[model samples]
Target: MTLQANAGQLLVHRVASEVAKDCFALATTFRGPGAYARGDQLVRAALSICSNIAEACGRGTIPEFRQFLRYARGSAHELRAQVRIAREYDPARALHCRTLESRTTLVIKLLTRLHDRPPPDR
Candidate 1:
């Protein structure tokens, strides 16, 4: 509820939004059947990362929030793997995938810092 925590949330939300946009762009850009399968997986993992972060931020306890952040981080890792496979199927998407990987790395760092913050009551 403090201004500081609110600012942190806004930052995370913005970063997450960026990641989601990248996912959508990459999914819609890459086309063949093989690319389709990998893209689908990538999109889902990307979406999960945002959803999990939202859930964590809204939770009632720090432990609950940390747990969800962990889930979100895991999703980021999953997306990394999926993007690698997607690149194999559609080499043209390599640049986008690399961009996504960089974004995901940033998200992971944000999540770690967010997780380490003191409980809201403190």
Candidate 2:
């Protein structure tokens, strides 16, 4: 392992970076008209997915990271729900949100696996 490198950190860092960048794109592309207020919900939830993972990975112990991963997972699920809302309430943004939601789900899957794996002993 290289300096400042570990399985958890590597996974969390990459996932977080992706989430951040993706959310930025989503925000930029968001349309103004919305009756369901899905735009704000999606932006927040998508951002949370990465931030929580990064925060959890930097925690003091594995159990703590697990707690954070749980948060990240919840955020991922919320992001999916928010995106789906676009389909029902804001049809125009639905596809774009779907793409972001799908990516968020993949990140969630990866994080869940990382959370389940045994932590390396330092």
Candidate 3:
């Protein structure tokens, strides 16, 4: 693999890692009834983003990689939706949720770009 491709992959991985960490931190803030279920779903969505990216990198074909990237983007969107719901459910934590939502948006944009780009020469 070329240095450029490696660097791009690393960047995506780093961003996804940060998202996961932030999601975990956010999940810990959940409280009251139904909190556990909501937090678990949020955490799962966040982890899915990272896992899909990793799976994409592992795939042999560019099409497979792009497909996985799409999956990752979908997870990011799901996480963003959960963040929005959390914001409404816990107004006290709205600011934190907003921040996480922004991060998820960034991840979505990054994944979309990666998916839309032309396949690198084999």
All models: lDDT?
0.77, 0.68, 0.83
Global CA lDDT computed for model 2:
0.68
**lDDT, candidate 3, 1-122, per-residue tens:** 41124423556668878988988988899999998899899999999998888878777577778888889888989999999999999999988989888888888888888888834745
TM-score of 1: 0.84
lDDT of 2 by residue, 37-66 (tens): 545676777778777776775775777777
Candidate 1 lDDT over 1-122, as tens digits, reads 32123423557657977888888888887776666776678789988988887777667667777898899889988887877777777788788878878888888888788888734643
Estimate the overall C-alpha local distance difference test score of candidate 1.
0.77
Structural RMSD, model 2: 3.9
- TM-score of each candidate structure, all chains considered together: 0.84, 0.73, 0.89
- Quote the positional error of residue 42 for candidate 2 in Å: 1.9
In candidate 3, clashing pairs total: 0
- Candidate ordering by TM-score (highest first): 3, 1, 2
Ranking by lDDT: 3, 1, 2
Q: After superposition, which runs of candidate 3 have C-alpha atoms over 4 Å from their true positions? A: 1-8
Task: Give the Å error, residue 50, model 3.
Answer: 0.3
After superposition on all CA atoms, what RMSD does each candidate show versus the true structure?
2.9, 3.9, 2.7
Residue 68 accuracy (lDDT) in model 3: 83
